[model samples]
Target: MSTQYEALKNADLYSTAFRVEPPTELGERKMTPRRPGFFITRSLSGATDAERAALKTATASQAEAPAANQAPDGSAPAPAAEPASTSRLLVPAQWGLVPHWVKSASDGKLRATKLVHVKSDNVGTSTAFRDAWLNNQRCIVPMQAFITDDYRSGGKPKPTRIARVDGLPMGVAGIWARWQDEDGSELLSYAIITINANAHGLMNRYQAPGSEKSMPAILNEGAYDAWLGSSAAKAKEFLRAYPAQKLLANPVEKGRKNPLGI
Candidate 1:
């Protein structure tokens, strides 16, 4: 399975100019999303200036005019010039998953109110996530890298960044949902999946001593195919970890938490 150690390699390292691509870094091994804590890129939001022009230019291929009585599929609404895919909205959410069952935003529990992540282990059983998982609501989270904890050194805190050895972008297994508020405002939400850690990496070095029980399950390009592909069995394979050696980890600075969640 994928661990935060591998995720950081995709990150911009203050230590050096080294970069990595997820596929080349992990070799041809099987991978999964992280189990617990994992990294996410939030600072980037909305469409870029160039993307707007591209959206307009490519509108013919991306958008489609919808029927009068039907709702536009959020992924690719009518007037195809605009991308019909939800990748734009999926890139950054409010940093949580809000199930459709919640009557109102306030009706959500603390867990759903501020959902940071969703474990693959609980995907099939979680009432909030099961529907999305069974449906084609799965997505891939793109990130340059990620951070993790290491508490094995007797209490001294150590933060680490994990990234791909190659410079290409990597995708983490994710699930997304579309929710409309009481006032008719609609928003998208998503959660990254996680798994367990491996030896000889940042996760092994930084995770709390004896408390190193979990890591994010990462899906590489190949595993990503099965995950996003049509086969339910193949998608299930994505729930496991890729190998460990493909990952490399290094120490990083722990920044203050984001107030609004990027």
Candidate 2:
């Protein structure tokens, strides 16, 4: 293995305690509901087709369950019962984007763990992301909020949670790829696209006091279709910082807890 790859293999930069708070109704965001398979770190495998279909139905049912169980007079139905399973509209996926051509499982695993974020400026040329970017293999990573290090305190950067002021899910730009092993098992992975945020009032304060400012490429509501279908040149134009006025941030205590529970 090359020295750079070896260093990445030794470091556990892929592990993140941050949890994305996905919206309850994905349709409200006008996102395409394609059933793309994704891998979660704990699960380590993609969901089967059957599982994906079932999840879709379960999500819809949960949304209408309240009205379905109500009476015409706005009263609760008799004989209260528990749901079969709690539906989760939001999916938890591994953060890294692994290329399809990795030679071995071990090598793929190492790269996937380390390649969590791809810089927007280099997406078209970086060896790690060029293929996916050139092929328009784009994806939307929806999240209500994400955690980052804030350095305004001047001493040491502190962990801060950032979310949209409107409390809607943020559609972060991303790229995905699939890797199949010799046995035919497959792993689908993704990485968030980030861009320079040095000029933004909100994002510029996120990193260490003087370090370069960076933020995820958050897409606007009407830009979803364009992002997934537009030419590479058009897509590149959308990879910019979200408006500072629309964001909110607060300090957070260090822990693995997901503030927005499923």
Candidate 3:
């Protein structure tokens, strides 16, 4: 999943920016999202000078007037009942999907027990994800882009970057939880939600026909309400894939996985 900053950028919000170190791989290179327009060479361990400045501004803004979840679009919504926090939590890619019941890092073993990918086939079932699904643990993973696989049948490996066609960044579906280490330090983790491939989309290009080894669970603007709102029923409906044409895939400079940049 992309970072919150990436999602905001995709939504056309430029003033705010968040930074973090991304993982080395995402299942396959073809599953990678496109390179974001903006990137900083700084490491993810500490905030860069630019990130520190941005954090100061964001912190001040939040302190001045905390958001009330007015709308899922990050805007003030009309009068309604209390709003669920639209606040997003950004964590390291290494820690993905920490279970709520975990008492310690050892307890977090279940993190690996469950598949990182959330399958659409078992929407209401799937013990692996049923709890998170019920508790509305869903979230948007802000990402610059993702890597995808193009398994060359009887050939070599093929990869591609699946980016937003509208020239925007994206926020993919994610589930998160908190875990504590032996020293009592709290840590957060998240996992990207994925779906099966459709007719002939990017998933199909590399994935064999009728393959379930591809595609991320992308939410559309209209469905953002149900997703962020945590309306399990409606969110399930929105989990359906958007038209393949809605996404744009392109070939990127191939080499070792290093810092992300244009």
Candidate 4:
């Protein structure tokens, strides 16, 4: 799995790419599974006028929300929650997803490391992701690029940057969770969804030799809203691999570790 990625740092790209207002505090350019990050989800003002009343009736609805002002650790705040009428909003979150059933923070951390990415076919069956998937806790993770180790050159693994050929931001499909402990403490986190790429022209070259190849389920520009609001039965429709011809991958410089090119 790809354990690190490049977050979107350009303010203007937010509006053009996702049609959401840009957050004042953009997160780290290079994000790891253990670092704090951000994601985009439907504005929690109830999803819609029709769903608002039903939202009140469902005790364990996917509308479960985190604190609007601060994350559980008391850092990485985004813009204030938009009015309940808005369609979508940006949110601050932990890069790794923490299921609500976790017994302790340490256990949650251990699980988080292994759950940085969930396979598209297993989201509904994996214990780590079933609840979130069934409840429709879907989200979009915005990134400039993702870093992976390429071994196709017949040598040691090489870190490569995979991004859109047009240099636009990517809205990768993801699932968010709100884990609340018995003491009332909460942790908001998310995990990226990956699809089988063993047969993909561009993605087939990533990962180690002989290992099953997979890539992030990057969504098309027009499907952002539909993906965030899709239900459990239809969510899989949005988890397809991006077109190979539209993505560009480049090897990182010999000593440059930062994807921001600084």
Candidate 5:
């Protein structure tokens, strides 16, 4: 699995590419496992039933004596100006998947580092990610590029950065989950989905020599909203590998570490 990636440094890209305004301050440019990163999810902007009940009670009281430009009738809870169903939330989440069954924070951290990438085929049946997948907690991970290792040099692996050929951002398919401790503290995390790229013209060259090749499940720009709203059964349709020809890879400089993640 590709364990490292580069975040979008420009905040405007989040708005232009994902249609959500990012935080004025972004996180680290290079995001490894356990780092904080942003994700895109569907946002439902409507009042809760309890809030609607309170409005109903107050509106009834005012109806007894009408005023010149009275407020909207409380019979309908949603306001006309409410956001559309396609509204999205740009959420910041850790770069790992923390299942709700994780008993302690220490155990969760240890597992987070290893859960950075999930195979698309096994995500639905994997014990660690099954719940999140079935619950339809899908997300779009917006990033500038993902880092991998090219072993073609026959020596130490060279760190490679894979990005779109058009120089635009990519929205990778991912799943998100929320874990809560007994004290009510919460941790939100996510994992990027990967697919077999062994036959891919470009991605097949990366990773190790004998191992199965894999690349991230990058989605099309028009499918972001559909991916988030799709049901568990239909979500798998979006896990196909991105066209290898549309991606460009280049060597990125980093510290002396195991870029191959052996």
Candidate 6:
């Protein structure tokens, strides 16, 4: 291994830019409500059918006149019923996980954006991620690829993109949390789980010089259901580095197009 790679082998440098391309099958699955202004432009994972149906019904109801049960005075109608929860949908949430105890959304945003990845070794005990991990607030972060810094060239390191060789979306292991501000504004966010990659041949090739090498806990296709439904202990068993042989990496020139297409 090159000195640059060795120096950063224990580093914490990792990429947060990931692609979410929801397949057509996801549209048929039920989903939770989408929060306004919470969508990512690069994400292809659009709202689910359930969400669209609820929106259409709400619009139609609002267009109609007040119901006879209401008083003659012009007052607001009864609050709409809350949408029931469903497990079928794969919603696109923010990249970072924010703890529910955060004081303010603004503060939470700042902290969450910096916490895109949580160390698997400490996720179950860390103050910011422990509650979600313990409560089984797990989620699947589907991505086409993720960015990394490859220092294997020996001089200045270049940004590299890594993806599965099979061309399937990577289902990264993650934990999620829901935070709400005093004004009732809410934010749903998540963090990707990462494990030590210093010993992995493919993963040890990326990241800045002198930084710890780490890789996201990329889950196997057959393990998706188990990961989302299993306990923390069972989930931790899956937090291992993806096989080096199954990943492909390509370095991109600076100022050029992002290899992962961002």
lDDT of each: 0.47, 0.56, 0.47, 0.76, 0.77, 0.56
Tens-place lDDT per residue, model 2, 1-262, is: 0001001111111111112122233332111122232321111126677547645754554444322121111122232332323333234334576688898888877887567777898888989898878877777665556667766767865667677786555667878776788999776777778889999878777776667778888776445545666677778977766778788877766563532211
List residue ranges in candidate 1 displaced over 4 A.
1-92, 112-114, 198-202, 231-233, 253-262
Q: Which of 1 and 5 is the better model by lDDT?
A: 5
- The local distance difference test score of model 1 is 0.47
Error of 3 at 123 (Å): 5.7
Q: Across residues 93-199, which tens digit of lDDT does each residue of candidate 1 receive?
A: 43457776678866543445445466667876788888777765776665555566556566665655565555444466777666778797765666767766544
Candidate 5: count the clashes.
0
Badly placed stretches (over 4 Å) of model 3 are: 1-95, 102-114, 152-154, 181-183, 208-210, 255-262
**For residues 1-262, what per-residue lDDT tens digits would candidate 3 score against the true structure?**
1211122323223213222223222222112222222221111234446546554543444343332322223222333422222222233333245555666565565554354456666744766566767766666565556656555654654445666676554556656444456685655445566676655455567554345455677655333335656566766655555456667766546674532223
TM-score of every model?
0.59, 0.65, 0.60, 0.82, 0.81, 0.67
Lowest-lDDT window of 10 residues in candidate 3? 35-44
Best by lDDT: 5
- Per residue, candidate 4 scores C-alpha lDDT tens digits across 1-262 of 6798999868766655665556667768888876898888764432445334333432232233222221111122223432323356667789999998999998999989888899999999999999989988998999999988888777788888898887878889999888778787778899999999998888898898888899999876556666777779998986776778788998888876574354
lDDT, candidate 2, equals 0.56
Model with the higher lDDT, candidate 1 or 2:
2
Question: On residues 74-105, what C-alpha lDDT tens digit does candidate 6 reach at each position?
Answer: 12232232222212233445656678999977
Q: Write the per-residue lDDT of candidate 5 for residues 1-262, one digit (tens) a residue.
A: 6798888968877665665645668877878899999777764124345435544443343334212221122222321221222456677789999998999999999999999989999999999999989988888998888888899989988889898887888889998888889998888899999999998888999999999999889877656666888899898887777777678987766664644222
Model 4, which residues run further than 4 Å from truth? 44-86, 259-262
Worst 10 residues of 2 by lDDT: 1-10
Tell me how far the alpha carbon of residue 244 in candidate 4 is from the true structure, in angstroms, after superposition.
0.8
Tell how far residue 232 is off in model 1, in angstroms: 4.1
Candidates in order: C-alpha RMSD to true structure: 12.9, 13.0, 9.2, 10.0, 11.5, 16.3
